[model samples]
Target: MHKIEELKIWKKSIKLTMLVYQLITALPSNEKYGLISQIKRSSVSIPSNIAEGAGRNSNKEFKHFLSIANGSAYELHTQLILTIELGLISKEKVQPVLDLITEVQKMNYSFQKSLETKISILNTQS
Candidate 1:
Protein backbone atom coordinates (compact mmCIF):
# COMPACT_ATOMS: atom_id res chain seq x y z
CA MET A 1 0.00 0.00 0.00
CA HIS A 2 1.09 3.55 -0.64
CA LYS A 3 1.35 6.34 1.88
CA ILE A 4 -1.28 8.81 0.73
CA GLU A 5 0.18 11.61 2.83
CA GLU A 6 3.38 11.44 0.83
CA LEU A 7 1.72 11.45 -2.59
CA LYS A 8 1.87 14.87 -4.23
CA ILE A 9 -1.19 14.04 -6.32
CA TRP A 10 -3.18 13.16 -3.26
CA LYS A 11 -2.06 16.35 -1.54
CA LYS A 12 -3.03 18.50 -4.52
CA SER A 13 -6.39 16.74 -4.79
CA ILE A 14 -7.08 17.56 -1.15
CA LYS A 15 -6.27 21.20 -1.82
CA LEU A 16 -8.48 21.15 -4.89
CA THR A 17 -11.36 19.78 -2.88
CA MET A 18 -10.93 22.51 -0.27
CA LEU A 19 -10.86 25.23 -2.90
CA VAL A 20 -14.03 23.81 -4.47
CA TYR A 21 -15.84 24.01 -1.15
CA GLN A 22 -14.80 27.61 -0.76
CA LEU A 23 -15.92 28.50 -4.27
CA ILE A 24 -19.33 26.93 -3.87
CA THR A 25 -20.17 29.23 -0.97
CA ALA A 26 -20.43 32.23 -3.33
CA LEU A 27 -22.87 30.46 -5.65
CA PRO A 28 -26.58 31.08 -5.70
CA SER A 29 -28.72 29.37 -3.07
CA ASN A 30 -31.04 28.14 -5.82
CA GLU A 31 -28.22 26.06 -7.13
CA LYS A 32 -27.67 24.39 -3.79
CA TYR A 33 -29.42 21.28 -5.02
CA GLY A 34 -28.18 21.56 -8.55
CA LEU A 35 -24.73 22.63 -9.73
CA ILE A 36 -23.55 23.13 -6.20
CA SER A 37 -24.38 19.58 -5.24
CA GLN A 38 -22.73 18.18 -8.30
CA ILE A 39 -19.56 20.19 -7.81
CA LYS A 40 -19.32 19.19 -4.17
CA ARG A 41 -19.58 15.51 -4.97
CA SER A 42 -17.13 15.61 -7.84
CA SER A 43 -14.60 17.69 -5.93
CA VAL A 44 -14.68 15.38 -2.93
CA SER A 45 -14.38 12.36 -5.21
CA ILE A 46 -10.92 13.42 -6.43
CA PRO A 47 -9.22 13.16 -3.06
CA SER A 48 -11.42 10.36 -1.76
CA ASN A 49 -10.51 8.13 -4.68
CA ILE A 50 -6.84 8.90 -4.25
CA ALA A 51 -6.96 7.87 -0.61
CA GLU A 52 -8.95 4.77 -1.49
CA GLY A 53 -6.47 3.74 -4.17
CA ALA A 54 -3.55 4.33 -1.85
CA GLY A 55 -5.06 1.89 0.61
CA ARG A 56 -5.50 -0.84 -1.97
CA ASN A 57 -3.20 -3.89 -2.03
CA SER A 58 -2.04 -3.64 -5.61
CA ASN A 59 -0.81 -1.11 -8.13
CA LYS A 60 -3.52 -2.13 -10.60
CA GLU A 61 -6.21 -1.45 -8.02
CA PHE A 62 -4.62 1.88 -7.18
CA LYS A 63 -4.52 2.77 -10.87
CA HIS A 64 -8.22 1.98 -11.21
CA PHE A 65 -9.06 4.35 -8.37
CA LEU A 66 -6.75 7.01 -9.81
CA SER A 67 -8.69 6.71 -13.07
CA ILE A 68 -11.87 7.34 -11.14
CA ALA A 69 -10.24 10.34 -9.46
CA ASN A 70 -9.13 11.75 -12.81
CA GLY A 71 -12.65 11.37 -14.14
CA SER A 72 -13.87 13.34 -11.13
CA ALA A 73 -11.29 16.02 -11.85
CA TYR A 74 -12.63 16.41 -15.40
CA GLU A 75 -16.19 16.45 -14.16
CA LEU A 76 -15.24 19.18 -11.70
CA HIS A 77 -13.48 21.03 -14.51
CA THR A 78 -16.67 21.11 -16.58
CA GLN A 79 -18.80 22.15 -13.63
CA LEU A 80 -16.48 25.04 -12.85
CA ILE A 81 -16.77 26.22 -16.44
CA LEU A 82 -20.53 25.98 -16.17
CA THR A 83 -20.45 28.28 -13.15
CA ILE A 84 -18.63 30.86 -15.27
CA GLU A 85 -20.91 30.48 -18.28
CA LEU A 86 -23.97 30.66 -16.05
CA GLY A 87 -22.70 33.91 -14.53
CA LEU A 88 -22.64 32.49 -11.04
CA ILE A 89 -18.92 33.21 -10.66
CA SER A 90 -16.29 35.27 -12.39
CA LYS A 91 -13.58 33.64 -14.48
CA GLU A 92 -10.89 35.38 -12.43
CA LYS A 93 -12.11 33.76 -9.22
CA VAL A 94 -12.49 30.34 -10.79
CA GLN A 95 -9.38 30.26 -12.96
CA PRO A 96 -6.99 29.40 -10.14
CA VAL A 97 -9.12 26.45 -9.08
CA LEU A 98 -9.31 25.31 -12.67
CA ASP A 99 -5.56 25.53 -12.99
CA LEU A 100 -5.10 23.45 -9.85
CA ILE A 101 -7.49 20.83 -11.17
CA THR A 102 -5.50 20.66 -14.37
CA GLU A 103 -2.35 20.12 -12.36
CA VAL A 104 -4.02 17.28 -10.49
CA GLN A 105 -5.11 15.78 -13.78
CA LYS A 106 -1.59 15.86 -15.20
CA MET A 107 -0.21 14.34 -12.01
CA ASN A 108 -2.78 11.58 -12.17
CA TYR A 109 -1.90 10.77 -15.76
CA SER A 110 1.79 10.54 -14.94
CA PHE A 111 1.15 8.43 -11.85
CA GLN A 112 -1.08 6.07 -13.81
CA LYS A 113 1.56 5.60 -16.48
CA SER A 114 4.13 4.71 -13.82
CA LEU A 115 1.73 2.18 -12.33
CA GLU A 116 1.10 0.74 -15.77
CA THR A 117 4.80 0.34 -16.31
CA LYS A 118 5.14 -1.54 -13.04
CA ILE A 119 2.17 -3.73 -13.88
CA SER A 120 3.70 -4.52 -17.26
CA ILE A 121 7.04 -5.45 -15.76
CA LEU A 122 5.44 -7.70 -13.16
CA ASN A 123 3.32 -9.37 -15.80
CA THR A 124 6.36 -10.00 -17.96
CA GLN A 125 8.25 -11.52 -15.04
CA SER A 126 5.30 -13.70 -14.17
Candidate 2:
Protein backbone atom coordinates (compact mmCIF):
# COMPACT_ATOMS: atom_id res chain seq x y z
CA MET A 1 0.00 0.00 0.00
CA HIS A 2 1.09 3.57 -0.57
CA LYS A 3 1.84 5.93 2.29
CA ILE A 4 -0.92 8.50 2.49
CA GLU A 5 1.10 10.83 4.66
CA GLU A 6 3.87 10.87 2.09
CA LEU A 7 1.57 12.16 -0.61
CA LYS A 8 1.88 15.87 -1.40
CA ILE A 9 -1.79 16.12 -2.35
CA TRP A 10 -2.89 14.74 1.02
CA LYS A 11 -0.60 17.18 2.81
CA LYS A 12 -1.98 20.08 0.83
CA SER A 13 -5.54 18.96 1.51
CA ILE A 14 -4.89 18.89 5.24
CA LYS A 15 -3.47 22.39 5.05
CA LEU A 16 -6.49 23.54 3.06
CA THR A 17 -8.85 22.03 5.66
CA MET A 18 -7.11 23.87 8.47
CA LEU A 19 -7.26 27.12 6.56
CA VAL A 20 -10.97 26.62 5.95
CA TYR A 21 -11.56 26.15 9.65
CA GLN A 22 -9.76 29.38 10.38
CA LEU A 23 -11.68 31.21 7.67
CA ILE A 24 -15.05 30.03 8.94
CA THR A 25 -14.38 31.51 12.35
CA ALA A 26 -14.88 34.93 10.87
CA LEU A 27 -18.27 33.97 9.49
CA PRO A 28 -21.46 34.81 11.37
CA SER A 29 -22.66 32.34 13.97
CA ASN A 30 -26.01 31.84 12.27
CA GLU A 31 -24.22 30.14 9.41
CA LYS A 32 -22.76 27.58 11.76
CA TYR A 33 -25.30 24.99 10.56
CA GLY A 34 -25.20 26.15 6.98
CA LEU A 35 -22.19 27.28 5.01
CA ILE A 36 -19.77 26.67 7.85
CA SER A 37 -20.68 23.00 8.17
CA GLN A 38 -20.72 22.47 4.42
CA ILE A 39 -17.33 24.06 3.92
CA LYS A 40 -15.75 22.14 6.78
CA ARG A 41 -17.09 18.79 5.63
CA SER A 42 -15.99 19.25 2.02
CA SER A 43 -12.52 20.42 3.05
CA VAL A 44 -12.02 17.42 5.34
CA SER A 45 -13.30 14.97 2.71
CA ILE A 46 -10.36 15.67 0.39
CA PRO A 47 -7.68 14.26 2.65
CA SER A 48 -9.93 11.65 4.20
CA ASN A 49 -10.67 10.15 0.79
CA ILE A 50 -7.02 10.24 -0.24
CA ALA A 51 -5.96 8.43 2.91
CA GLU A 52 -8.70 5.85 2.50
CA GLY A 53 -7.83 5.31 -1.15
CA ALA A 54 -4.15 4.82 -0.34
CA GLY A 55 -5.08 2.11 2.14
CA ARG A 56 -6.97 0.13 -0.47
CA ASN A 57 -5.52 -2.96 -2.23
CA SER A 58 -6.01 -1.99 -5.86
CA ASN A 59 -5.11 0.94 -8.06
CA LYS A 60 -8.65 1.12 -9.38
CA GLU A 61 -9.98 1.56 -5.88
CA PHE A 62 -7.40 4.23 -5.21
CA LYS A 63 -8.42 6.04 -8.36
CA HIS A 64 -12.07 5.90 -7.34
CA PHE A 65 -11.31 7.49 -3.99
CA LEU A 66 -9.17 10.13 -5.67
CA SER A 67 -12.09 10.99 -7.93
CA ILE A 68 -14.29 11.36 -4.86
CA ALA A 69 -11.71 13.63 -3.27
CA ASN A 70 -11.57 15.71 -6.42
CA GLY A 71 -15.34 16.07 -6.30
CA SER A 72 -15.14 17.31 -2.73
CA ALA A 73 -12.52 19.83 -3.74
CA TYR A 74 -14.88 21.17 -6.37
CA GLU A 75 -17.71 21.22 -3.84
CA LEU A 76 -15.53 23.20 -1.46
CA HIS A 77 -14.67 25.57 -4.25
CA THR A 78 -18.34 26.25 -4.90
CA GLN A 79 -19.10 26.75 -1.22
CA LEU A 80 -16.23 29.22 -0.94
CA ILE A 81 -17.55 31.17 -3.87
CA LEU A 82 -21.03 31.19 -2.34
CA THR A 83 -19.59 32.42 0.95
CA ILE A 84 -17.90 35.32 -0.85
CA GLU A 85 -20.98 36.15 -2.89
CA LEU A 86 -23.06 36.26 0.27
CA GLY A 87 -20.52 38.63 1.83
CA LEU A 88 -19.83 36.11 4.58
CA ILE A 89 -16.13 36.46 3.76
CA SER A 90 -14.25 38.83 1.55
CA LYS A 91 -12.79 37.62 -1.73
CA GLU A 92 -9.34 38.69 -0.53
CA LYS A 93 -9.49 36.32 2.46
CA VAL A 94 -11.05 33.43 0.54
CA GLN A 95 -8.82 33.65 -2.53
CA PRO A 96 -5.87 31.90 -0.95
CA VAL A 97 -7.94 28.94 0.18
CA LEU A 98 -9.53 28.75 -3.24
CA ASP A 99 -6.10 28.75 -4.82
CA LEU A 100 -4.95 25.93 -2.57
CA ILE A 101 -8.08 23.92 -3.39
CA THR A 102 -7.40 24.44 -7.07
CA GLU A 103 -3.85 23.24 -6.62
CA VAL A 104 -5.02 20.15 -4.74
CA GLN A 105 -7.62 19.46 -7.42
CA LYS A 106 -4.96 19.58 -10.12
CA MET A 107 -2.70 17.33 -8.12
CA ASN A 108 -5.53 14.88 -7.56
CA TYR A 109 -6.28 14.82 -11.29
CA SER A 110 -2.69 14.17 -12.22
CA PHE A 111 -2.38 11.48 -9.58
CA GLN A 112 -5.52 9.76 -10.81
CA LYS A 113 -4.29 9.85 -14.39
CA SER A 114 -1.00 8.32 -13.35
CA LEU A 115 -2.85 5.58 -11.51
CA GLU A 116 -4.98 4.88 -14.57
CA THR A 117 -1.90 4.50 -16.72
CA LYS A 118 -0.35 2.17 -14.18
CA ILE A 119 -3.50 0.10 -14.07
CA SER A 120 -3.60 -0.09 -17.83
CA ILE A 121 -0.02 -1.32 -17.93
CA LEU A 122 -0.75 -3.90 -15.23
CA ASN A 123 -3.77 -5.14 -17.10
CA THR A 124 -1.78 -5.45 -20.31
CA GLN A 125 0.92 -7.45 -18.52
CA SER A 126 -1.67 -9.78 -17.01
Candidate 3:
Protein backbone atom coordinates (compact mmCIF):
# COMPACT_ATOMS: atom_id res chain seq x y z
CA MET A 1 0.00 0.00 0.00
CA HIS A 2 1.19 3.55 -0.75
CA LYS A 3 -0.03 4.76 2.60
CA ILE A 4 -0.52 2.85 5.83
CA GLU A 5 -3.91 4.43 6.29
CA GLU A 6 -4.94 3.13 2.89
CA LEU A 7 -4.23 -0.46 3.78
CA LYS A 8 -7.29 -2.59 4.52
CA ILE A 9 -5.43 -4.18 7.41
CA TRP A 10 -4.90 -0.79 9.00
CA LYS A 11 -8.53 0.15 8.52
CA LYS A 12 -9.68 -3.14 10.04
CA SER A 13 -7.29 -2.68 12.92
CA ILE A 14 -8.73 0.76 13.61
CA LYS A 15 -12.22 -0.66 13.58
CA LEU A 16 -11.13 -3.41 15.95
CA THR A 17 -9.58 -0.87 18.32
CA MET A 18 -12.76 1.17 18.37
CA LEU A 19 -14.77 -1.93 19.11
CA VAL A 20 -12.52 -2.78 22.02
CA TYR A 21 -12.85 0.71 23.41
CA GLN A 22 -16.61 0.44 23.31
CA LEU A 23 -16.57 -2.97 24.97
CA ILE A 24 -14.30 -1.81 27.81
CA THR A 25 -16.48 1.19 28.49
CA ALA A 26 -19.08 -1.19 29.82
CA LEU A 27 -16.62 -2.80 32.21
CA PRO A 28 -16.88 -2.40 35.97
CA SER A 29 -15.55 0.85 37.39
CA ASN A 30 -12.79 -0.99 39.27
CA GLU A 31 -11.34 -2.40 36.07
CA LYS A 32 -11.13 1.01 34.40
CA TYR A 33 -7.39 0.97 34.97
CA GLY A 34 -6.59 -2.70 35.14
CA LEU A 35 -8.02 -5.00 32.49
CA ILE A 36 -9.45 -1.99 30.74
CA SER A 37 -6.08 -0.36 30.25
CA GLN A 38 -4.41 -3.56 29.19
CA ILE A 39 -7.09 -4.34 26.63
CA LYS A 40 -7.01 -0.86 25.14
CA ARG A 41 -3.24 -0.79 24.88
CA SER A 42 -3.06 -4.16 23.22
CA SER A 43 -5.87 -3.33 20.82
CA VAL A 44 -4.33 -0.04 19.82
CA SER A 45 -0.93 -1.66 19.38
CA ILE A 46 -2.25 -3.80 16.54
CA PRO A 47 -2.84 -0.86 14.17
CA SER A 48 -0.21 1.46 15.55
CA ASN A 49 2.53 -1.05 14.94
CA ILE A 50 1.23 -1.74 11.46
CA ALA A 51 1.44 1.93 10.59
CA GLU A 52 4.87 2.25 12.15
CA GLY A 53 6.11 -0.78 10.31
CA ALA A 54 4.75 0.43 6.99
CA GLY A 55 6.71 3.64 7.45
CA ARG A 56 10.00 1.77 7.59
CA ASN A 57 12.27 1.88 4.51
CA SER A 58 13.13 -1.80 4.46
CA ASN A 59 10.89 -4.78 3.85
CA LYS A 60 12.65 -6.66 6.64
CA GLU A 61 11.87 -3.89 9.08
CA PHE A 62 8.27 -3.79 7.93
CA LYS A 63 7.96 -7.54 8.40
CA HIS A 64 9.43 -7.24 11.87
CA PHE A 65 6.85 -4.61 12.73
CA LEU A 66 4.07 -6.74 11.29
CA SER A 67 5.26 -9.60 13.49
CA ILE A 68 5.05 -7.36 16.53
CA ALA A 69 1.58 -6.26 15.50
CA ASN A 70 0.54 -9.89 15.20
CA GLY A 71 1.87 -10.54 18.67
CA SER A 72 -0.18 -7.67 20.05
CA ALA A 73 -3.24 -9.02 18.27
CA TYR A 74 -2.81 -12.37 20.00
CA GLU A 75 -2.40 -10.59 23.31
CA LEU A 76 -5.70 -8.82 22.78
CA HIS A 77 -7.33 -12.08 21.83
CA THR A 78 -6.10 -13.64 25.07
CA GLN A 79 -7.42 -10.75 27.10
CA LEU A 80 -10.81 -11.14 25.46
CA ILE A 81 -10.88 -14.76 26.55
CA LEU A 82 -9.93 -13.72 30.05
CA THR A 83 -12.72 -11.18 30.05
CA ILE A 84 -15.18 -13.90 29.17
CA GLU A 85 -13.86 -16.25 31.84
CA LEU A 86 -13.85 -13.54 34.52
CA GLY A 87 -17.49 -12.82 33.82
CA LEU A 88 -16.62 -9.29 32.92
CA ILE A 89 -18.34 -9.80 29.55
CA SER A 90 -20.81 -12.33 28.34
CA LYS A 91 -20.04 -14.67 25.44
CA GLU A 92 -22.70 -12.86 23.42
CA LYS A 93 -21.33 -9.44 24.25
CA VAL A 94 -17.82 -10.46 23.25
CA GLN A 95 -18.68 -12.41 20.12
CA PRO A 96 -18.64 -9.47 17.71
CA VAL A 97 -15.30 -8.27 19.03
CA LEU A 98 -13.90 -11.77 18.75
CA ASP A 99 -15.09 -12.01 15.15
CA LEU A 100 -13.45 -8.72 14.24
CA ILE A 101 -10.19 -9.75 15.90
CA THR A 102 -10.17 -13.02 13.99
CA GLU A 103 -10.68 -11.23 10.71
CA VAL A 104 -7.85 -8.81 11.46
CA GLN A 105 -5.56 -11.65 12.48
CA LYS A 106 -6.21 -13.43 9.21
CA MET A 107 -5.48 -10.28 7.22
CA ASN A 108 -2.28 -9.68 9.17
CA TYR A 109 -1.12 -13.22 8.48
CA SER A 110 -1.79 -12.81 4.78
CA PHE A 111 0.05 -9.52 4.68
CA GLN A 112 2.97 -10.97 6.60
CA LYS A 113 3.31 -13.81 4.14
CA SER A 114 3.17 -11.39 1.23
CA LEU A 115 5.85 -9.27 2.87
CA GLU A 116 7.99 -12.35 3.38
CA THR A 117 7.81 -13.13 -0.30
CA LYS A 118 8.63 -9.58 -1.33
CA ILE A 119 11.52 -9.46 1.10
CA SER A 120 12.92 -12.69 -0.25
CA ILE A 121 12.86 -11.26 -3.76
CA LEU A 122 14.45 -8.02 -2.64
CA ASN A 123 17.21 -9.91 -0.85
CA THR A 124 17.90 -11.92 -3.98
CA GLN A 125 18.02 -8.74 -6.07
CA SER A 126 20.61 -7.17 -3.79
Candidate 4:
Protein backbone atom coordinates (compact mmCIF):
# COMPACT_ATOMS: atom_id res chain seq x y z
CA MET A 1 0.00 0.00 0.00
CA HIS A 2 1.12 3.53 -0.72
CA LYS A 3 1.29 6.31 1.83
CA ILE A 4 -1.58 8.66 0.92
CA GLU A 5 -0.09 11.61 2.81
CA GLU A 6 2.94 11.57 0.53
CA LEU A 7 0.94 11.68 -2.69
CA LYS A 8 0.86 15.06 -4.34
CA ILE A 9 -2.41 14.25 -6.11
CA TRP A 10 -4.09 13.50 -2.82
CA LYS A 11 -2.73 16.70 -1.27
CA LYS A 12 -3.79 18.80 -4.24
CA SER A 13 -7.24 17.19 -4.27
CA ILE A 14 -7.63 17.90 -0.57
CA LYS A 15 -6.86 21.53 -1.27
CA LEU A 16 -9.37 21.47 -4.13
CA THR A 17 -12.04 20.06 -1.84
CA MET A 18 -11.40 22.77 0.75
CA LEU A 19 -11.53 25.51 -1.86
CA VAL A 20 -14.76 24.09 -3.29
CA TYR A 21 -16.33 24.06 0.16
CA GLN A 22 -15.40 27.67 0.69
CA LEU A 23 -16.69 28.68 -2.71
CA ILE A 24 -20.04 26.93 -2.43
CA THR A 25 -20.99 28.52 0.88
CA ALA A 26 -22.03 31.64 -1.01
CA LEU A 27 -24.44 29.81 -3.29
CA PRO A 28 -28.22 30.30 -3.08
CA SER A 29 -30.08 28.53 -0.29
CA ASN A 30 -32.58 27.01 -2.72
CA GLU A 31 -29.74 25.01 -4.25
CA LYS A 32 -28.91 23.61 -0.84
CA TYR A 33 -30.60 20.34 -1.84
CA GLY A 34 -29.79 20.54 -5.53
CA LEU A 35 -26.62 21.64 -7.33
CA ILE A 36 -24.90 22.60 -4.10
CA SER A 37 -25.35 19.13 -2.70
CA GLN A 38 -23.94 17.49 -5.82
CA ILE A 39 -20.98 19.84 -5.91
CA LYS A 40 -20.14 19.00 -2.32
CA ARG A 41 -20.28 15.25 -2.86
CA SER A 42 -18.16 15.34 -6.00
CA SER A 43 -15.52 17.57 -4.44
CA VAL A 44 -15.19 15.35 -1.39
CA SER A 45 -15.18 12.20 -3.52
CA ILE A 46 -12.00 13.23 -5.33
CA PRO A 47 -9.72 13.19 -2.29
CA SER A 48 -11.67 10.58 -0.39
CA ASN A 49 -11.25 8.09 -3.23
CA ILE A 50 -7.54 8.82 -3.46
CA ALA A 51 -7.11 8.09 0.24
CA GLU A 52 -9.18 4.95 -0.09
CA GLY A 53 -7.11 3.68 -3.03
CA ALA A 54 -3.86 4.38 -1.24
CA GLY A 55 -4.84 2.04 1.54
CA ARG A 56 -5.53 -0.85 -0.80
CA ASN A 57 -3.28 -3.93 -1.07
CA SER A 58 -2.31 -3.44 -4.72
CA ASN A 59 -1.66 -0.73 -7.27
CA LYS A 60 -4.50 -2.02 -9.41
CA GLU A 61 -6.98 -1.35 -6.67
CA PHE A 62 -5.48 2.06 -6.12
CA LYS A 63 -5.79 2.85 -9.82
CA HIS A 64 -9.46 1.88 -9.73
CA PHE A 65 -10.08 4.30 -6.91
CA LEU A 66 -8.14 7.00 -8.74
CA SER A 67 -10.40 6.43 -11.74
CA ILE A 68 -13.42 6.91 -9.53
CA ALA A 69 -11.89 10.09 -8.18
CA ASN A 70 -11.27 11.37 -11.69
CA GLY A 71 -14.88 10.70 -12.61
CA SER A 72 -15.97 12.68 -9.57
CA ALA A 73 -13.74 15.54 -10.66
CA TYR A 74 -15.49 15.64 -14.02
CA GLU A 75 -18.87 15.47 -12.38
CA LEU A 76 -17.84 18.47 -10.33
CA HIS A 77 -16.64 20.28 -13.44
CA THR A 78 -20.00 19.80 -15.13
CA GLN A 79 -21.87 20.94 -12.06
CA LEU A 80 -19.71 24.04 -11.73
CA ILE A 81 -20.31 24.96 -15.36
CA LEU A 82 -24.02 24.42 -14.86
CA THR A 83 -23.95 26.68 -11.85
CA ILE A 84 -22.32 29.38 -13.92
CA GLU A 85 -24.77 28.98 -16.81
CA LEU A 86 -27.67 29.07 -14.38
CA GLY A 87 -26.21 32.28 -12.91
CA LEU A 88 -26.25 30.75 -9.50
CA ILE A 89 -22.59 31.67 -9.18
CA SER A 90 -20.56 34.03 -11.30
CA LYS A 91 -17.86 32.69 -13.61
CA GLU A 92 -15.33 34.77 -11.72
CA LYS A 93 -16.17 32.94 -8.52
CA VAL A 94 -16.21 29.47 -10.05
CA GLN A 95 -13.29 29.76 -12.47
CA PRO A 96 -10.59 28.96 -9.98
CA VAL A 97 -12.37 25.85 -8.78
CA LEU A 98 -12.81 24.67 -12.36
CA ASP A 99 -9.13 25.24 -13.07
CA LEU A 100 -8.12 23.22 -10.04
CA ILE A 101 -10.44 20.41 -11.03
CA THR A 102 -8.88 20.35 -14.46
CA GLU A 103 -5.47 20.09 -12.88
CA VAL A 104 -6.64 17.21 -10.71
CA GLN A 105 -8.10 15.41 -13.72
CA LYS A 106 -4.85 15.70 -15.66
CA MET A 107 -2.86 14.48 -12.69
CA ASN A 108 -5.24 11.56 -12.26
CA TYR A 109 -4.84 10.55 -15.90
CA SER A 110 -1.08 10.64 -15.65
CA PHE A 111 -1.08 8.70 -12.40
CA GLN A 112 -3.39 6.09 -13.86
CA LYS A 113 -1.10 5.63 -16.84
CA SER A 114 1.86 5.19 -14.52
CA LEU A 115 -0.01 2.53 -12.57
CA GLU A 116 -0.97 0.81 -15.78
CA THR A 117 2.67 0.70 -16.85
CA LYS A 118 3.67 -0.78 -13.52
CA ILE A 119 0.96 -3.38 -13.73
CA SER A 120 2.06 -4.28 -17.24
CA ILE A 121 5.63 -4.71 -16.13
CA LEU A 122 4.61 -7.00 -13.30
CA ASN A 123 2.48 -9.06 -15.62
CA THR A 124 5.25 -9.44 -18.15
CA GLN A 125 7.65 -10.59 -15.48
CA SER A 126 5.21 -13.12 -14.16
Per lDDT, the best of the predicted structures is 1
Please write out the lDDT profile of model 2 over residues 26-122, one tens digit for every residue. 9999999998999989999999999999999999999999999999999999999999999888999999999999899899999999999999999
Give the candidate order by descending lDDT.
1, 4, 2, 3
Clashing pairs in 4: none
C-alpha lDDT of residue 73 in model 1: 95
- Report, for every candidate in turn, its global Cα lDDT versus the true structure: 0.97, 0.95, 0.90, 0.95
> Regarding lDDT, does 1 or 4 come out ahead?
1
What value does the lDDT take at residue 80 in candidate 1? Answer: 97
Regions more than 4 Å wrong, model 4: none
By lDDT, is 1 or 3 better?
Answer: 1
Model 2, C-alpha of 8: deviation from truth (Å): 0.7
Model 3 residue 33 CA deviation (Å) reads: 1.5
What tens-digit string does per-residue lDDT give for candidate 1 at 37-119?
99999999999999999999999999999999999999999999999999999999999999999999999999999999999
Angstrom error of the Cα, residue 15, model 4: value is: 0.4
Pick out the ten consecutive residues of candidate 2 with the lowest summed lDDT: 1-10
Q: In candidate 4, what are the lDDT values of residues 1-126, reduced to their tens digit?
A: 988889999999999999999999989999999999999999999999999999999889999999999999999999999999998889999999899999999999999999999999999999
**lDDT of candidate 3 vs native?**
0.90
Q: Is candidate 3 or candidate 4 better by TM-score?
A: 4
Over the stretch 1-126, how does candidate 3's per-residue lDDT look in tens digits? 349878999999999999999898878989988888999999999999999998998878888888999999899999999999999889898989999989998998998899899988988998
